[model samples]
Target: MTEKNPSQKTVSSRQNIRKWLLIISFLLIPVTIFYISPIVAMMGAGKGIVTSAILLYILLFVVSLVVARLWCGWLCPMGAWQEICSPIFKHTVADGWRNWIKYGVTVLLFAMLAFTFISAGGIHAVDPFFGTVNGISITSFQILMIVVIIFLIIFAAAFFTGRRGFCHVLCPIAGLMVAGRKIRNLIGWPALQLDTAAGHCIDCKKCSNECPMGLDVNGMVRQGDMENADCILCASCADACPKGAITYGWKKK
Candidate 1:
């Protein structure tokens, strides 16, 4: 057999690196969730106003303003879990009104936070490690069971709805990121995005097939509309496209 070209090998290597990075992030979730869970933050917020989880969400939103949901692709443990389930259920999500579910969940969550803070008189105290047992998430059997149940729900969403279905339908954090990304787009700020050259496309559907979010990447490329709100800027399409038609780039306006 002939040797693989260097550029193709490079793309493959990058894709593998991305996968490993996501896996590493997934492995770290047992620790990370102690500092990132909205549920925990909300519980703390009910007693006080500021917590590590709230701060983490804020940081993620700020990063999303520049990177457009990169957290969902590169760092989210939930995304990693859903992807790990892809082998058993490689389902495609249909484009429809179901996409509004996340928005509703986000709005409700924000409303709850507002009510809780208002009832508490707002910012009375701060505890970065609130709701966590000495900064550890799995401190008890009950907590471990809760975490397991949460992961099961996320996996079930992916299995039933499609790849990354929880991100598409139920993740309040995704809604927050989408809002930040939209703000960046509206402000014409330089941000991470996909750049496509339709002329180089060979009509192969690899991009769509490889998309973890189940987006219509091939149609987007053919129509020269590569800026998708749902896109996580993962660049899997860029790595999969044999024609080198798609690329990740920083775009202003």
Candidate 2:
């Protein structure tokens, strides 16, 4: 039997940290769900109020300037839920024309938001607690059912399709972060970005296999480029690299 590489062990340990963090995030969904929900945002917008979700969408874009889709990687309850189901469904989702569908969803969501605000004469108030009862989201049986249905949809996407299938093709919030990250790339800011030392790679393919987003990390490394809109900066490739070929660093490009 081949011995385990120390670097591989280190990466595996790091991934475990991410796993536990995701689990904690998932457990806290009841408290945090409304805050990150676009549905809540639209509801608030219709009543001429700015919701927490609106603020978070803005924050996601702003933070993506420095961190890319770190929220998707480390703290998203839905992402955590999908990963929990990943043990039984370890397939990779495809990034095709369907992947672009989320942008249209984002546009429609925001367009409705804008229309609502306009109909209400624009921003009559700002209430981060607009949709919550004492900042708790699943406050009633109806709400609990909604949450359950949403989670079931997320689970269905992951189960019937592949890992992060919802994220890759259906998530409405990802567009904001992707835009921010792309702008950062254009602006050349020293943000949280990945780097690859192709010379250090040995074609073991562990990085590609470890990528939760189902990216071609091995191909990215071979090309000496780790920049991708879909990359959540989870560092799975970096951690899984037995040769330390992939690494994360704060820099542009």
lDDT of each: 0.83, 0.86
lDDT of 1: 0.83
TM-score of model 2 vs. true structure: 0.94
Error of 2 at 163 (Å): 1.1
TM-score of 1: 0.94
lDDT of model 1 at position 205: 88
lDDT of 1 by residue, 1-253 (tens): 3322236668778778878988997888767776878788788778866888778788988998899888888778888888878887677777887777998898888888888888888878778877766677777889889999999999888788888889888898788899998899889888888988898887778899999898999999999988877888888888888878887878886
Per-model TM values vs. the true structure = 0.94, 0.94
lDDT of 2 by residue, 1-253 (tens): 3334467776678788899999999999989999998889988998999999999899898999999999999989998998787777677877678678878888888889999999989999999988889888888999989999999998887776677888888899888889898898888879998998899788889888878877889999999888988899898989878778877878756
Per-residue lDDT, model 2, residue 204, is: 86
- 203 Cα displacement, candidate 2 (Å): 1.7
Candidates' RMSD to native = 2.1, 1.9
